[model samples]
Target: MKSSRGILCSAVLLIALLAPQCFAEDWLYTVRKGDTIWGLSHKYLKDPLKFQEIQKYNNVKLDRQLPPGVTLKFPMEYLKFAPAEVSVSAINGEAYFVRRGVRATLNKAHKLVLGDILVTNKNSSVALLFADGSELLLGESSELIFDVQTKWGETGMVDSRVRLMQGSAEGRVEHLRGPGANFEVQTPSAVATVRGTEFRVRLDKEDDGIVFNEVNEGTVSVQLHENKESVKEGYGLITSAKLPLAKPKELLAEPKLVNPRSKYLGHPVTLTWQPIDEAKSYQVELFKDKALTTLVHKAQVSSHQVSLPEVNLGEYSLRLRAIDKDGLQGLNTIHHFTISPVPRSPQLKAFDEQYIAGQPLEFSWEESVSATQYRWQLAKDRQFRNIVTQQELKNNTHQLPEGLPAGTYYWRVAAGNIHGFGQYSTLKRFDVKRPKPPELSLSDKTITTEDTLTVDWQAVPLAEQYLWQVSSDETFSNIVSEGKSQTSHLVLEELPESELYIRVAAHGPYNQGRFSETKSVVVEPEGNGKTAFGIGSILLFILIL
Candidate 1:
């Protein structure tokens, strides 16, 4: 009897050791706006039909629209065994997690537990391990639940918030509504709150204490939990739980007052001011009135070379401000200028009909009233090479020097005065197309819903029309904006922030050539109010020097 009992005990112990293998795997996936079962199956299982198995096990009926902010789970039997796990924890109101393998997603209703570790997969599913070592893994391609309620024991808590663990997880928050409806995330030291808005949070361990929070729309508040310090609008916050929180300081320097100077209409504006140390770039805003009304032109440039546009006989107010990448604005430096009676539109007629290699090429544009000098450039590629000629011309004709070459050449011209220069003329490319229409490119290609799409492209020919277009499909059959000019290279209005397919095309007359080849741009619209304070250190160093 004793020997038989010993054998049974050994068998029981063996089964207990192998219990983990019996559980299989669990996954968490959040549903986005346009997600389909077919997409989910192919994404996680490499077969759309596999989604059926997942749905049956998860008790989800087929053909249900997996709306945004929904969380779903996949069982172990349907998955292929490449399970991953991550850990997570909640401090303050936000829940933090890390993904190891597989994938994970978040929905609006599911509250993330503090000290939870998650494992992820390619299908955007997640397995959440709580601080108490409890596990909750989602289904493949299922909607996520992004809700938070801190229950002291078994009762539900009110605030619902979570930090991104890994992979891409996007969702909406519905319960946190109204003026007092507050949702937030608390790092070890920092707190991020949502103010009637939708947003995205991405986790990148490689970056040092940098939490990339993007705002698709509405406003978010990133505050130091210890100090309640926060920055508003479209800004980024870089913080770490290991470090103590500091007061939110604006990193922008006060702009120097540019000397009040006279400007001539139809001429390049010579704007010279003491160089600022920490300035990443300068923004020049030209207004028509002393009250700073009727903003005529605004441009952001590293070097100050703003060409005032041809005005229709009126006095205008000018205000210039310098901004760092952190979105901090400096004091506005104001100036005044007047446009005397000028022609309706200035014209640049190419003097040379064609470029005869090895011969002098003389190009001249028709002079406008109140014009003084001309800015000209010669180049091989779109970028100029030789002396960028700025000549004080009483007359319009400029002589091209003899450079013995047997190939085509490109030249560009711009009219300038005291305030600034009018736009540069259409690049005349005898040998090739004039400086490649400013190649519109983006800072980032793939983005979440809460990010912005920064549109850029080659500058349009002076006076030529520029149009910006965006489409879910590559072929921009449905363009976004009607024909507009390229006064500003950036477009940040009414854009659906996501991994959208984008292309920009510049248009001129057929004689000028077909619209320049469409260029691609990617935009990520996220805001956390963390300014670049290091720029201050750099500026201080420059001041010392």
Candidate 2:
């Protein structure tokens, strides 16, 4: 009977040792060198004799020594501990996790336990997802500590708390069905508690103790010590560690785009927006695509309108947003616009192939639809090496400043707008015809006692009349005689007793021709009867000798 009782007692003890306690907190520890079961139990449970309980629960034989790297499980009856309720879903750059005074590099799929602090290096970022479907995203140089008050298996309402020690964090909390479910985030100067909402909390690294909270979707109650303020969607609150909570202020509204109106690319774009009453300033951003990922330009202005610099020929997108006095940004208002292709060259209008010199030359061309201005050029050479005249005219028709010299000329025109100049028009040829001068002949080269002299000239093709002039000098500055002729001949009845030079030219309706070659004549005085007798006697005496 005694042996049977001992056997029954041993069976009960074995069963108790093998069965795990449902309510006890458990920890998995790896054994190291110089670490004994008694020392571990004393350090963890504060009782050295509790080592026997660890030995019995692990089914370790008394004669065998604990291995250096063997894993052991310890159940705590008084202290409660649990596995991490959150996991690191994404990590970028360098990040670290600290738990129970042990720090390790944070990586994807790493579990985050309560009271674990996560730190992100410069230009690094981390994202965490909790078992309750809440998410937290940390910006660069940020520190976040998980201080959840609820476990994964808890049934009743509990609090989900996170503390931001430095930098910024954006949170999206899952909706809670129960009454007591709460999600709260605390910074140095402010604490934001919400039922469920999308919000951002930032602790200023420069100011040491300043905090800011912005609600994006739902209401958030921000508390600074004993003072509290409720922030709604599209609003924000700011406070310092020692100051009272400031009143919630309205964020700027999305700007309304006024110009561009779905136009093509290439022209200068005038960006206009409806001004907001509470906005202190505005920002304009231009992107290469609709997604707005590739930024092309960014400008800040106090006015509601801005004219963008010349952009290339392509598709583009523009966005506008307002900034309040406190630097809180409003919702973005986006617009899509494109630059039109370059304008086509203008078509030239029909014009005369020949023009008279010293007459007004009018140039005309067909209007280009997209051209705001037209540029025309007239050159002496086909390659435009010697440009005669060039002008930019607003209208399609332009009058030459003066008639070009008599020569063959090449001309072309191009259309242009704010974007750029288009191709040049096809080259055109024209000529300026000069008037022809007449050929003059004198009836007498020498006039000895003659009272009349007649001058005749050949007829010019386009000449309406002829002009004759006689001068004592070659320059014709002092004219001795001048006359207009209907036909090709002119007669001078009164002769001067000096050398004379005469020339003739033809005249047209528009211009006067060049002068013809000059003809010379000399006039002499007449003699008396006594002088005639003396001259005849001298000639007769010479013949007789």
Candidate 3:
């Protein structure tokens, strides 16, 4: 009885020790009354293959299943995680500070020096916030810094701040996340902030006296110092030690003129506006009769010059608006000017005249006011592409080149002035005439007797002489006579015995005009045929008759 009681006590001690192990919980776990080894294994261990692990841990047989009220140790391989933070630094000598509800972009890698701010926006204008929940917006040619960095932790925490130095810029505070996240912009004299909406702020490098702020879209509360303060909107707050957020009524300060004679009536014009009251830059708006023509120029400049090319006769005006770094415009102003037209085109006349072949004529024309040069083009065809002469003449006259081929020629001239060259004059046509042809008449049409052949013709109209020939086969190969100078007919006293052909051509100054029709004649003795002399005489009479 004593041994059984001791065994039972030992069994109870072992059960208490292995209660957690038998349950299969990897970490600490308090045993519950209804929990069993199988239930605990399924709940904690999960893997069915590891069900036997409980038996091995307790030094019990596999067949001897897990018992209730036993402890077990479990391994730790399952859990969940979260995203880390991003690392950032500053650029240039600018410092940064950040808290919450702020965002911005860093220009380069840097260590934070000053300014508690965070990135509120990264767009055309970067927004930054201060520890006091103030806001600053950066425009083009602007730089800023942030305070928060990834070294502490990278959990997307609002950590950095920024500052705007040197260039033109704007700032606005929409809504602060809390009282701790206050936003502000620091210049030489004033720190500006807004309760809601948008506003602009600017600072100058050379002189701190030019620091100014404007509330374009929202209300801005400004503090020049702890003692002095003011709020401005739809207007600007100009600040210095003397004036703390003071409101000036008239702001349309005159812009300095840069090159006065920058453009002419026929030249391109460039107009530039000057910065006013130490403002960072200015904008020039050009108008033609009150209509906005162009926002001609914008820059951080003291003056601007506009170019106008070939300005017509009209009235012109230019209006300018001065802008601070905050994008606020001052009163609109105007600069008036005038433009005039140049003189009319010059006149030209091409004289008409006839010329002989190989002879040239002189061409001249009148010039108009302001005519500086003349252009002459001459050609044989009307198209003028076959230009025989394309010369720029300082004088209004040019003699046509001699030895031009015999043909009708066309020519014209143009005048050039400051504005442009005028249209060419009407083309003039001239002729180079060739010599004329002579008139001619033939001699005789027929011949009867062999011994005598009488021929007759008339004189050529414009000829010095006539070219005459007589042939037998109608080809005029056998010439009875060469060119004859006589005006009347020629007698072929010693004529050929065979039939003959005769032709007469007229020669004149130009060419041979026409030729007489060919005439045929048979030259055979009439006598000595059939009673010779008497029969010849009778045949001759019969032929003649």
Candidate 4:
């Protein structure tokens, strides 16, 4: 019989082998009363004659049946297993995987095997989740290959290996439970091996054969042909075919946005940010989601200013990072901004008019072709809650009625379509300072029976003209004759032989006063041919009193 020690020379070796292979049960077989090494090898081992190999690892007799309850340790590598699987948890954009040689859509429940290739289109990404809860994000325009997918049977340990052929990928590896757990990423120029970390790997698009590696959490070891460098959290490095593994360089500081009036108000959105000391350039990216997985725009700029062409107004997330002279992109600063689509406010003409109480006010604005209508508001305050007049009309001009209490008033106009409205124009102040105009009074009230009737009104001070109307009714809605006269005297060309109403208003340079009180008149022609006539039932009949 062999000694207590099998092929294992020391207890240290046995412990090393036992601890890492937690599935050591997979290598052991229970001894039965009728079991022999000869019978067991033929049943379990591929080569039956290799029963002697089992004898080297376990002190067992081949010539007799082994005692019951005894256990035999077999090599784990020599055992047989099937292809392993990685559960596909999620995907974004148009990402697919090719199994063996058949292309298929990658879904939540899809399982990927070794030799499977994952691909992402432009502006797309894919997320791969392994059975061990490790997650990997394959970035836009990327291709990744599953090199090895294996797990020791029920050992709670996994060995995952993937090769990035192009573009970028980020990973969040679960903490290893045992020595058998490993996650590795291999690129063209370098390889990254991590026990548990959050990291990113990118093959430089500049065709320099450079691989960029960034560690956000835990530690990552980057290996070139013969050199290796350990990158810790908050640090990054780059490796090229021409150079050795580089020392981990601390990432640059994030750039801070410095625009105070940053509503993203106008076209060609322009934003400025504070510059970093070591930054040679900056990269700006926009995403629609807060998680920043959906990339919309990416650009590299030399200055601290970020300018983007007109984009749809909505909620978005932006990422800004500075690039150093060593071609390493620094840490990112993320922010949430909203782009609200609004129409342009119409331009208003200057308000230079003398205002009077109970007088018409005219306000006009420049034409806006984009607006189908305009909203004009006359308010007591700028907030427009205490509004005097608010209306939406197709025309650009607004007319305020008479009887506005003469104090400081505010007015504004905004252009709008069916979709939405734009910003309101600057509040305009209207100071009602002009005095009420003087009412015109007729000096000569005598009646005349002639075909032409003449009436004279008192010429008021600063009166430029007189506007008189002869109406058939008292309300002056049915005006029979109307004319403007420079003098205070008005002559009626024709006088109807019936009851009529006459009114007149004095006009100044810019505005006209209210019409005078209506006067009812009836003309009586004498039987004798003469210019003298009599007025019958005339209100306020007096001799120029």
Task: Quote each prediction's TM-score.
Answer: 0.25, 0.41, 0.28, 0.51
lDDT (Cα atoms) of all candidates against the true structure? 0.49, 0.75, 0.51, 0.75
lDDT for each residue of candidate 3 in 387-506, tens digit (9 for 90 to 100): 877888888888855535456888887676665565566678888664332333334444445455566666543455777777777766666655564565666666756677767776
Deviation in Å, model 3, residue 138 alpha carbon: 3.6
The sequence of per-residue lDDT tens digits that candidate 1 reaches over residues 1-545 is 99999999999987554222333435556778887666777665534587777777666775467677777665433433221222332111122233343243443344344333433333234444322233333322222333342221111112344444333332233433212123555443345676545444444445424444444345567665445544443443445555555434343444664564664443345565665777778868665556442344556778744666544557777767565655444445677776644332246684554543434457777776555666666666566655444454556777756432444556666665665555566677664223334466676656544555566665654325565556655666755544455564664545564334555455543213334455544434443222356667789999999
Model 3 residue 519 CA deviation (Å) reads: 59
Q: What TM-score would candidate 2 get against the native?
A: 0.41
Per-residue lDDT of model 4, residues 1-545, tens digit only: 24555554677685553332334434566788888888777766546687887887796655476789887876655443334688755566687889878898777777887889998888777767786778887888899998877665554557788999999988889997654567999999988999889888988887637988988789999999988999998899998888877789998878988863435432445678998889999989877767665567778899999866556777778889888898777877888876656566678899954565545678888876568888899888878889987889899997765546567788888887776666677788877654444444443343444556666767754457888888878888888788899997777755665566888777764346556777666654543343234443243367445
- Per-residue lDDT of 153 in model 3: 16
**Over 4 Å off, model 4:** 1-93, 105-109, 152-156, 259-272, 305-316, 336-545
* Distance from true location, Cα of 326 in model 1, Å: 3.2
Candidate 4 TM-score to native: 0.51
Those runs of model 2 whose alpha carbons end farther than 4 Å from true positions after fitting are: 1-84, 89-94, 100-105, 152-158, 257-321, 331-545
RMSD of each: 37.3, 19.4, 29.2, 15.7
Name the candidate that leads on TM-score.
4
Clashing pairs in 2: 264-338, 264-339, 264-340, 265-338, 265-339, 265-340, 266-339
List ranges where model 3 is wrong by over 4 Å: 1-162, 177-181, 242-245, 248-281, 284-320, 323-545
